[model samples]
Target: MTYCVGVMLESGMIFASDSRTHAGVDNFASFCKLNLFERAGDRVIVLLSSGNLGGTQAVISILRQNGKRPDCPSLWNAESMFDVALLVSDAMRLVDRRDGQHLKKNNNGFHASFILGGQIRGEPPRLFRIYAEGNFIEAGDQTPYFQTGETKYGKPIIDWAITRSTTLNDATKCVLVSFESTMRSNLSVGMPIDLICYKLDSFAVTMRRRFDPDDAYFTTLGKEWSAGTREVFGRLPDLDW
Candidate 1:
């Protein structure tokens, strides 16, 4: 299992994903789930993927392979972020069609989902949650973010503190804290996390980082968040009942 999130703000956008993948309690490993397709001064697309590892990897591989062909309508030529989402959805469907039946017969899984967010030339930054079935929904003023896989544990923090107006810096902190909350509750989702912060209209990614287990900032942030949460809870008035 994994956790991936993307937030679109007035200033820009933030993307993050955990690297943990496990077959069982005794068998665990890490794989970077964050994928990027960037063309300086043209577009900056970020994909945070989750679900069946094979399926997600195949889908991403297909997108990358197709994006190189000028004859195909790929992410490189997509005029808008909506088009990019469609391209991703199409690639996902292609993978499902090829592997779904075989996986089902073996009682295996071919489910994969993605959070796609970025800026295409001319359009503002956009975010979408693409489902396993290849259909997707866009983030709007009311819902300016998207999450996939192991999402419930980290959602409350984002819901309470994030808004469309949140700054990239603050949003980055909120996102990391959300991940900390999730890792505390679920062992399957963990570090090292891949994070990217893209400023609007830059058409380039200026900031990207990987937070390993020993990463000082991430470690400190997690500790501070845990302590702060406990302190806040301690201050809450107790029930008389």
Candidate 2:
């Protein structure tokens, strides 16, 4: 399991994903769930995956391999963000065709989901949530972000804190907060989270970072947030039947 989040704002976008993947609660390993496709000034696309590890790895490998092919539809030749998404969707379906059946037979389905967010030359920045079925929907004003894997616990923070006008920094803060909330309640998601913020029209990632258990900022954030929550709770009146 994983918890990956993407936020789309007027200024740009923010993406983050946990590194932990597990077959069972006792079996935990750190594998980066975030993948980046960068082409300098041409485009900057970020992909965050959650679900069956084998299927996700296979899909990413195929995307990277096909993206280098000139004659085929690849990320390099994608004219717009929409085209980039289609390429990803197609790649996903190809992987599913090859592995989905086998995985199903083994008692696990082709459980893979991705959050695609970034910008390309000649277009405004965009963000999308690509499904395991090779179809996707873009983030719009009404829904300026998307989340995958263990999403429920952290969703409320984004729903309450994010908006189209939110600054890149503020949105990043919100995402960190969301990640903390989810990790507190779920053991499936864990440390060394990857984070990136891309500025609109930059065609390059503006900021990229990672946070682990010992990371100063994350440690401080967790303490402060927990203390704050406690204080707030203490201030509330007790329920009277």
Candidate 3:
């Protein structure tokens, strides 16, 4: 399992993902679930993935290769982020057709989902999540972020603290806190965490970072968040019996 989030703020976009994947309690490994496609001042794209590793890898391989084929729809040639979403969706479907039936017959469901977001030269930064079945939905003012894989434990903090007006720096902090919240509660979502921030209209990745357990910022944020939660809890009025 994994935990990945994409946050869209008025200032820019923030993307993050945890690196753990496990087949069983005894079978565990780390793999990067975050991928990036950047074209300097032309476009910037980030992909956060969850679900079956095979399907996800297959899907990405296809899309990366597709970008080089002139006759087909590809990220490099797509005019808008929405079209980029469609290209991702189609790549996922192609992977499903190639492997889904074999997996299903063996009793493993063909499951993969992705959060794809970034900006093309002429468009605003955009974010979307594509599901197992090849359909997707975008982030908007009404819902300025999206999460995939082991999402429940970390969702509330984003709900309470984030907004479209959030600055990229603060929003980046929120994602770390959100990831910390999940890591504390779930073992399947381990790290070194992958993080990337792209300022709106720049068409280039603004900040790219990775946080392992010993990283100073990640360690401090975890300790502070825990202490602050306890401090706030103690400040509330006692409940009536």
Candidate 4:
């Protein structure tokens, strides 16, 4: 299992994902689910994947390979974040076409999905959640974020703390805390956690970080959040019942 989130705000965007994968407790491993396709001054696209690792990797590989050929439309050539999402959905469909039947024959299913978000030259930053069926929905004013994989454990904090007007720094903290909340409840989702904070029209990713198990800041953040939560709970008025 994994957890990935993309938040689209009035100022910019935030993307994050945990790097844990496993077949079982004894076979735990790490694989980055975050992928970037950037053109420094023109665009910066981030992809956070979930579902079957093999299928996800295959879709990414196809995107990169097809990107190399001028005749093929690719993330690099896409004019808008919407178009980038379409290309991703197309690639997913391609993978399903090629390997879906084979995986099904062996009793496995081709399941993969992505959270695609970023900025292109002429447009503001945008976010989308692309499903396994080659369809997607964009983040809106009412719902400014998208999440995939093991999401339940981490959702409340985001819903409570994030908004279109939230600052990047605060959003980053909220996102990390959500990750902390998730890792605490699910061993399937572990560190190192990858994060990116992109400012509007920057067309570049100047802030990127990865927090491993031993990272000082992440550790402190988790502990403080736990303590704060308990403190808040302690303050709530007791019921007469």
Quick one: RMSD of model 3? Answer: 1.5
Of 3 and 4, the candidate ahead on lDDT is 4
> Candidate 3 on 1-241: residue-level lDDT in tens?
8999999999899999999999997999999999999999999999998999999998899989988899978889999999998888888888888888899998996899999999998888899989999899999899999999999999999998899998787778888999998999999999899999999889888699999878998999888988988999999999999
- The C-alpha stretches of model 1 lying farther than 4 A from their native spots are 230-241
Candidate numbers sorted by TM-score from highest down: 4, 3, 1, 2
lDDT value, candidate 3, whole model: 0.91
Model 4 regions more than 4 Å off: 234-241
Model 2 misplaced regions, further than 4 Å: 227-241
Model 2 C-alpha lDDT per residue in residues 1-241, reported as the tens digit of each score: 7999998899888999999988788789999999999999899989899888888898899889987788878888889889888888887888888888888898877878889988888888888898888789998899999999899999998888799998988788889989998999998889999999998888887599999878999878778877877998999999999
Residues 79-134 of candidate 1: C-alpha lDDT, one tens digit per residue: 89899899889988888889999999989757999999999888888899999999
lDDT of each: 0.92, 0.88, 0.91, 0.94
Off by over 4 Å in 3: 233-241
Candidate No. with top TM-score: 4
For residues 1-241, could you state the per-residue lDDT of candidate 4 as single tens digits?
9999999989899999999988889998899999999899999999999989999999999999988999989998998999999999999998999999999998987999999999999988999999999899999999999999999999999999999999999999999999998999999999999999999999999999999999999999989988988999999998889
Give the TM-scores of the predictions, in the order they appear: 0.94, 0.93, 0.95, 0.96
Worst 10 residues of 4 by lDDT: 102-111
TM-score of 2: 0.93
Candidate 3, residue 66: the lDDT equals 84
The local distance difference test score of model 1 is: 0.92
